[model samples]
Structures are given as C-alpha cells and as structure tokens.
Target: MKFKFVALVATAVAAQFVAPVASANDQLAQSICAYVADNNKNNLRKTLSDNRLRLKAVYDGISCDGLPLVRFAIKNNAADTAEFIIKQLPGSQVAQSGDIEWANSNGFAASPILEVIKARSAS
Candidate 1:
C-alpha cells in the first residue's frame, strides 16, 4: 500500500511537470504563428532568437493552421516573411517540399514569392 501511494504521488508530480512544458510549446507555436501572420519579420526573428531556435531547425516541426511556416505565410499574404523563410532554407529543401508547385497551382503563380522560390531552388 505504501509503494502504491508513492507511485501515485510520483505520477502526479510527473504530470504536473509535463503539463507546463506542453503549454510552453503551445505558447511558442502561437507566438510564431502570430508573427508570421502579422508579417512582422523582425519580431519573428527576435522570437526565434529568444528561444534559441533557428528557422531551419524548427521549420519541419512547426505548423500554423495545418500549413507549414512558409505556406502559412503565403496563405496570409505575408510576403516578407515568406521571402525571409525561403532565404533561410536551402534551395534543395524548398524544391523538395513542393512549395513551388503548390504556389503555382494555388493561384500564387503571380506572387513575387514564387520568383524567390524559383530563384532559391535554382541555386
């Protein structure tokens, strides 16, 4: 009975520790999404810097409204953010992610961001 009580207490303590971490991650994601949606490039950079995260490192892990970071920026008409993201990532990553094709098919062909994507992918 004593062991069971100890285990239950331990589990409760562990859960308390975990909940805050999950909430912190959610808060970070929300902040990042807000920055991208608002087209606030400088704030985005500062947020990432504050978290000690690089765009390239966290790009694959972050999604805003079910869209990848660059895609979310484009969907929100956040051109500066999109361009900044494309510049941060490698050309091959951009090409492989199908961003160029998606942009063309989704009526974003005329966006200057497409040109930037192409320019980045070519190099």
Candidate 2:
C-alpha cells in the first residue's frame, strides 16, 4: 500500500511539472488585451516590451474581428501604439488595415498610417 501511494504521488508530481506553461506570446496577448480594455497607453507601452509579445502574437491578437485589448487603443485613436505595432509587424496587412479603419471610423483619424496601408496594398 505504501509503495502504491508513493507511485501515485510521483505520477501526480510528474504530470504537474510536465504541463505546458503559458507561452510568453500568450501572456503578452493577454496583457495587451487588458491594456486596451483599460485604455491605459502607458501600461500598454510597457507591456509591449515583453518578449512573449511576438509579431505573430500581435498579429493574431489584433487581427480578425480585432482583439479586445488592441480594440480599445484603436477605438480611442491611440495612433502611436498602433503605429508601434505596425512597425513591429510590418507584414501584417490585415492587422494594420483593421487598426487604421477602426481608428478612422471611430473618429480618431490616423491618416498617416492609413496612407502606409494604402501604399502597401497598392504594391
């Protein structure tokens, strides 16, 4: 009985240790989402430095219908933050376009970024 108990405990410990931790990209996405929701530009800027916030994560998080985190910044006309993200993921046309449109439609004109998107689209 003691041996069986030890084996079970060992198995549980191994399973716990082997579980995959949240990737840095995932953490960054969550943080970005939070910052966007809070409309806290300063916190958003700081969160961008996390290595887990990769270009792919940024693109994935901000693209499609738009992630809630970045949606806040886009809606608020946070052009600088949006620009920074564009710079980070230059290849992300969908994210760039979505952000620019969200800003423009929401009364936060980001013409310069829009111009860039247009130029890229033209090419």
Candidate 3:
C-alpha cells in the first residue's frame, strides 16, 4: 500500500512538471502575439531569438504562414524589423498572399517594400 502511494505521488509530481513544459509552446505563442499586438518589436525579436520561446512553436500556435512577427513590426511602424522578416521569408506563400494585404490594410502602406512583395508574388 505504501509503495503504491509513493508511486502515485511520484506520478502526480511528474505530471505537474511535464504539463507546463508542453503548454509553454502555446503560452509563448500567445505572448508573441500579444507582444506584436502591443507593438514591442525589441521584445518580440528578443523572444524569437530565445530558444525557449521557439519561433516555430509560436508560428504553429498562431496558424500564421507568414512571419507573424513581421506583422507585429509592421503594426508598430518598425519598418526595419518588418523588412528583416520579409527578407527572411523570401518566396514564402504567406509573403505572396495575405500578409502583404493585411499589412497594407492595417496602415503599413503600399510603399516600396509592400510593392516589392506584391511584385514578387505576382511574378
């Protein structure tokens, strides 16, 4: 009976430890999304660089095909950061599709960068 009790306690503790690690991906995703929404490009970029935050994990959580991080940059008016994300995802379908559309619609404007994305996508 004591052995069984110990085993159960251990199992419970192990589950507690593992559960948050698994859910961290989603938490990180939401954090990234919120950061973008809040327009914190420096923090967003820093989080992206942190392996624990996991860019792919965040991307997976948001269902974003394009670099959603870039959307955050664009929203924040951080043109340089947005340009970086665009360069990173060159030739991506998200770049070709609604990412640019959303950016333009949201107030990024149809400037040279937006035009380039549209042109490349058109080609």
Best by TM-score: 1
- For residue 102, give model 3's deviation from the true position in Å: 1.8
Model 3, range 1-123, lDDT digits (tens) per residue? 999999999999999999999798667777666666565667777878885554534453463224556565565655554554454454555454576778767777854457556654664
Q: Estimate each model's TM-score.
A: 0.93, 0.49, 0.53
The global C-alpha lDDT for each of the candidates, from Candidate 1 onward, is 0.89, 0.56, 0.61
lDDT of 1 by residue, 1-123 (tens): 999999999999999999999999899999999999999999999999999998899899899999999888878889998999999998899989887778778987777778888899999
**Prediction-by-prediction clash tally:** 0, 2, 0
Ranking by lDDT: 1, 3, 2
Instruction: Provide the global lDDT of candidate 3 against the true structure.
Output: 0.61
Better of 1 and 2 by TM-score: 1
lDDT of 2 by residue, 1-123 (tens): 999999999999987766645454456567676655455656766765544445545555453235443355555545565455555554545444465566577775744555544554455
Off by over 4 Å in 2: 1-11, 14-20, 23-27, 35-53, 61-72, 95-113, 119-123
Judge candidate 2 at residue 27 and give its lDDT.
60
Best-performing candidate as measured by lDDT:
1
For candidate 3, list the clashing residue pairs, or say none.
none
Instruction: Tell me the deviation in Å of residue 85 in model 1.
Output: 1.1
Candidate 1, residue 69: lDDT = 90
